[model samples]
Target: MRRDPKSTTVRRTPWPEGAERALGTPLQPSVVYTAADPDALDRIYDDGAPGFTYAREAHPNAEVLAAKIDRLEGAEGGIVLGSGMAAATAVMMGLLKAGDHVIGADQLYGRSLRMLAEDLPRLGIATTLADACDASAIEAAIRSETRLILIEIVSNPTLRVADLERIAALCRERDILLAVDNTFTTPRAIRPFEHGADLVIHSVTKLLAGHSDATLGYVAARDPELRERLRVTAITLGLTASPFDCWLAERGLFTFELRYDRAEENAAALAAHLAGLEGVQVLYPGRSDHPQHDRAAALLGTRFGNMVTFQIEGERDAANALVRAAGQIGFAPTLGDVSTTLSHPATSSHRALTPEARAALGITEGTFRVSVGVEPVETLCAEFEAAIRAAQA
Candidate 1:
């Protein structure tokens, strides 16, 4: 893959004036670093600067990746964590105290919803679920004790777009922090910070990593104090990402723009094609029929993301048959892979939600979500056409 010019330039650190210099930041897999003197070590330990302590506290590769993410997101600072959930956990633990309340979107990733609804309450942190797409509903859910408003830029599986700017305004007026999960739209499509968000989080296991090989998460903050709080919490909780995974994910970032462009184009085309099919109900932000189409266009510009969801005209069995008939597409639970894949939220990501809850989110048994890849549009459409036909038969 060709290196992005900006990445190539920023990835390399200047070498000491006279010694041999390397073109790029070499992977430093050392679990610990040694300081030149006790005074230097004391300074390092006290400052908690990058690469000055044990791997779990800080590491070179992770710092490099964090810097890259911070630059990309235009954040004051950032940190990398073991997984997306780890990042979320660190944020909650760092920012909220016992008795604090959090307002979250009802259409969140299943695991996130479960954590908010079940786990946080156990720790004395109250949570209220509301429709994040509705700014009025979100405002109504807020209370005097509310400390945070958590939402996704584009909701999981169902592709609902949140009015982030308006929500951010509300949070600001109420003196509450707004944390946005940018996993679906990513920094390439939309930078939540630009729209007044206080913190932006991403699951690097998805588009930032590009490939499906690494598990990593990142959080970028507009405030340095908040970033430090998150970093300290991650260190205390031992939630730092592995050095090797950070390196791999950084490599993935090199090709992210290219991959996202192709996948987005393919997704738009697929959505249009699926909408024309006789027994399909397509849901994509790019389509005029989507309820949030104008909002998405205004917020994301031309990049409408790579996910396309639809429901077949039948019961759960027919949807299952359709997935089985799509011989050319891989059936995977995750998204943001280079190869096109399909996932059933009812069985995979959102299975923990009750039937009524799922129905409220418009996630029916016939609903199927596709993560479009950088494949030839003609080939992908043809294969899908055949699969749909076979399923109908």
Candidate 2:
């Protein structure tokens, strides 16, 4: 008689066997794994069992990290990669073939836009850039060859919130795959899977890691077939994340809830203060003055995220000076650090776009992107105030 597939009586060996043990999953940094017998190794490889054969294909640490993230995002399975761009590349290469077309958000991370606009075309894949916030625009841009729709949950620098649910519905009607970049909002703020997103990508270097140290990314999908395809592509491209970094990211995941709560509080207080300051135009999803504030509230609920973008009244020099005067803050190109950091879009994140394009997107030289950290609200406000005063002087 055949056993019931759903039976919970399946026998399993105790983990770690004997001798080697750990309260947490121990870091396995070995570049290659081995089995007691050659035939056993061949069986493991042929069966595609859960044992690691090579670091590039899979490993214990990366598996642990991926599992935690998969649970958080409500995905059937997921894979971690060397960087966020690598994850995006794997998704595009795995799911899309030559002659396929992709529809992307007009406002995206600068590098992502570059890939869709320049790189994908070179590979015989066509792409159309549309305003994801406008469902009609996306619908109009779709073609018969369209295979995927790419969007960011909360757009970079500008903080525009996409209508994910509406877009997902549109994608379903067209039988197109919907891929969401959830780096900015994170699973803690909003799980795109809950909104019908087929695939969710996150730059683990950002909020998931909670510190600026780890360089990692992950792609999660509700379909096991999609997840497996992405994993194979990641392995083929040699985009696997370092096991050490994966271990560190897992540690960071433990404190994500606490860190995110504090950071959100800091962002709210700082955004409110900045809005009232002289010569400052603050753009935060939490603020009702923002263009997509209502949408953000509905999708993200109470957590509005830790990013706030504002423009100083003067020129680029004034913005630079203000950043310099903020003695405690670091001017870094990246976000989601433990301490409050500032980034200038014109010279950093959005530098790839032409001047005309940047202008069209409303990202001027005076614009500054703030990655709010877990700092005291009063301290952050005081430092920003002093910096503004110095910039005006």
Q: Who wins the TM-score comparison?
A: 2
What pairs collide in candidate 2? none
Writing each residue's lDDT as its tens digit, candidate 1 over 329-377 gives 9898899998899898989999998888888899988788899999999
Could you give candidate 2's per-residue lDDT for residues 1-393 as a string of tens digits? 887876655754345567755788677788987677887788887986568788999988998999999888888678999989999999999999999999999999999999999999999999999998889999999999999999997898899989888899999999999999999999888888889899999899998897888999999877888988998899998998999899999999999989889999999999999999888899999999999889999998888999999887777778778888997898899998888998988899889999899988889988889999998899999998898888777
In terms of lDDT, model 2 sits at 0.90
Clashing pairs in 1: none
lDDT of 2 at 374: 94
Clashes of each: 0, 0
Q: List candidate 2 segments past 4 Å from native.
A: 1-20
354: Cα error in model 2, Å: 1.1
Candidate 1 achieves a global lDDT of: 0.88
